[model samples]
Target: MNISSLKLDSSNTVLVTGGAGFIGSNLCESLLSNGNTVICLDNFATGKRENIAGFASNNNFTLIEGDIRDLNTCKKACSNVDYVLHQAALGSVPRSINDPITSNDVNVSGFLNMLVGARDANVKRFVYAASSSTYGDSTNMPKVEEIIGKPLSPYAITKYVNELYADIFSNTYGLETIGLRYFNVFGRKQDPNGAYAAVIPKFVMQLMSHESPTINGDGSFSRDFTYIDNVIQMNIRAIASNNKDAINTVYNVAYGERTDLKQLVELLKKYLSEFDSKIKNVETIYGPQRTGDVPHSLASISKAKKLLGYNPEYNIESGLKEAISWYWKNLK
Candidate 1:
């Protein structure tokens, strides 16, 4: 979380695709804080303009209303950019299942456009937001970067394809890229209103309203719920690292631990009750397990630790405390 420790160049101009969404917006803020010039390109399909609205007056910030699916837009955004933090993608398994065409068009095609743009522009490093969904049906305890199973859903296929495209781009065009396979990232600014909203923020919103949040299954499904700040750290490290071995490879960005839905809701109730004691009385309901959902997911950040020097500052308990406080203050 120490921006100074990252040793990022203030003079560098970075382009953050999907800069109005949760993780992308956070990256924009962090890069701007370090006195770097930031160009944000987003179609606002899922990203909100208000997320980056605060930067309107900051001279260092620039917003380009465009989608990554368009090669021209990607090329324009990549113009004179030192680095490209590609976060633009249509995310969600059920959403993809509901409509695979749009998902593939955006996640896969859009990714390809950006890769081509970055390659043509000769960007220094192309860091991307890869997904843990790439682990798919794998039952691995501590998901390593190299060991991956077949993708389970259309969304997973798109993300896995992203890694393949990144690898190919690195090899074919000599464009340096690093893919951070994020595991269940959650924190402030994360949207909780959508039908496919992530569990933690969605649960927090429901609990804050005293509504009984429904669990997908008997509540045993687990994930390596990562914090947004930790994710930001890994991205910056990817940019700052001079290690040749780290470039052109993917690394798992996680806290190296897992928490089941049962324990997760308990922790949510525990944290939210600190703001409103009545939250203790709220309940939860069980439902059929969601399709394409793995029973368990954990990560081994050893590769990141060894190469990028990744050290996560927040665990599940600590991360939930911070995230809940933000939701309590901001929740409508």
Candidate 2:
């Protein structure tokens, strides 16, 4: 989907929290390219400064080095901003399991601070990152918006809390909000080096170096792997859509197709092999399933398509091919 053609007002100032992270940095670049003033607020905890360095020189780009856990920082970032894309939160289920307190402090408390700041500032709309983990334990083949199960981890709880808070803020304070329940998003600029790095990027890096990529289970675990461009398109649509019914609700931002871990590795190797054939021979190791890991997750993107007019441009194979090219050039 070509989001640049959307009717978003380029004259407005948009605030993207965690703007130095993978997803946030992409949004910042897209927004800036579309001629919008962008203020990026990040503390550099998990977000790297280099991610935003490319566009920092752009006149329309501004960086506010601050933490969202601090209400004052959140308020300052929101001041004079026309829209808020809140993406600053600690990710990874295992990381949350190890440090639940810190995760809650940032994801839950920090989210509330942003909402309050946006509400007080009278921003036109508050679009934030929600998670597919909110579908925890639900065995539904294709997870929908209305049906959800108990959170499987502290991280899941934090994301679900975001939806609840967004709903309440819209009802009580009259803040127009949209929560995007992102599936397993992966693409360029996604971190490939971290103890809690996502599966796709991490595996890509490992395979590039001819290291054995380990699977948590027997490689049957599946996820609705989404590409970053689709996610960016969804965020833009959320801000651009004037549809009243779409304002205060959440929609699953995904490709609506599940890819198993085995299939995922095969695809990654297939693409990376084009750059270095040795990657094709790299063996994979299997490990016990990690705690809080959902056996399978798939999203029904009908809500996003029907309401927001979402049209995901790339599926797993195509997105992986593009991602492999980036990793080969950048990380090789």
Candidate 3:
């Protein structure tokens, strides 16, 4: 059985909020793959059960249809869970602009509930999803954790608030918590049909359908698109890191590189056309600039490197190649 290794105590449970969503599902799969018992909580607001479909039959996995905003739900999910990976949140800057209240309720209020729940249950470590949007209006090329700018969108505000609250909780309650400020993470299981869908998946789906994808604002906008495996690796290392300096702190989880939207489009078109030659000449449609999008994003992983030994294994080109292939096989 692939269920008795990895130094995991079979009785020690791990809970992942939003575990049915893209990143959460991937994290759950990796933990289960390494012989850990996992409890996954999701309201399916933006998550899909199909994302975690492959784990349904695994005896070590349990799925709970619940929202993180509910104190009772968080309490129940936290029971006996040794570690908490909080990934539940409503993302997208435009979506937050349109409905800041709901975003606040989930991203802020929901995060507090998980913090309280994890604290009450005495979880060994609480690792949650923080976002690059926190870098906000900063002009710095490679964003470091110590420096940040004013939030430009409701989404950015909410994610930054998560780190702030985590700091408060750790100081006041002595709960060991770590936040990974992920920069443009993308990979398999990322939903492609939503209006607020992320760029990589949306582009892959559109290219697969022979439809044109849109590159907002001259295709010059750049991001440090990290693959999901690297993100999962950060979570593992964040919890497992023995460095006293690493605990109860946040680190930038990214590839320490930048790729423009136009370049990304070219890469997508190039890789996808390999699956179908018809996709070769599919031109992209550029529209008015998106509302809260920062022009460029690059992260400095030096702190994570020194503290957590986090060496990202995939760069954007390699990651996009794998992501495109997955969408071609599964979504086409």
lDDT of 2 by residue, 240-328 (tens): 99899889999999999999999999999999888889989999999999999989989999999999999999999889988888888
Each model's TM-score? 0.99, 0.99, 0.97
lDDT by candidate, in order shown = 0.93, 0.94, 0.90
Encode model 1's per-residue lDDT on 226-323: one tens digit a residue.
99999999999999999999999999999999999999999999988888899888989999989888778999999999998899999999999999
Query: What's the distance in Å from true for residue 164, model 3?
Result: 0.9
Q: What shift in Å separates residue 186 of candidate 2 from its native position after superposition?
A: 0.4
* lDDT head-to-head 1 vs 2, winner: 2
Clashing residue pairs, backbone N/CA/C < 3 A, model 2: none
Q: RMSD to native for every prediction? A: 0.7, 0.7, 2.0
By lDDT, rank the candidates, best first.
Answer: 2, 1, 3
* Candidate 3 C-alpha lDDT tens digits along 109-165: 999999999999898889999999998899987899999999999999999999999
**What value does the lDDT take at residue 15 in candidate 1?**
97
* Candidate 2 lDDT for residue 261: 99
Worst 10 residues of 2 by lDDT: 1-10
Candidate 2, TM-score vs. the true structure? 0.99
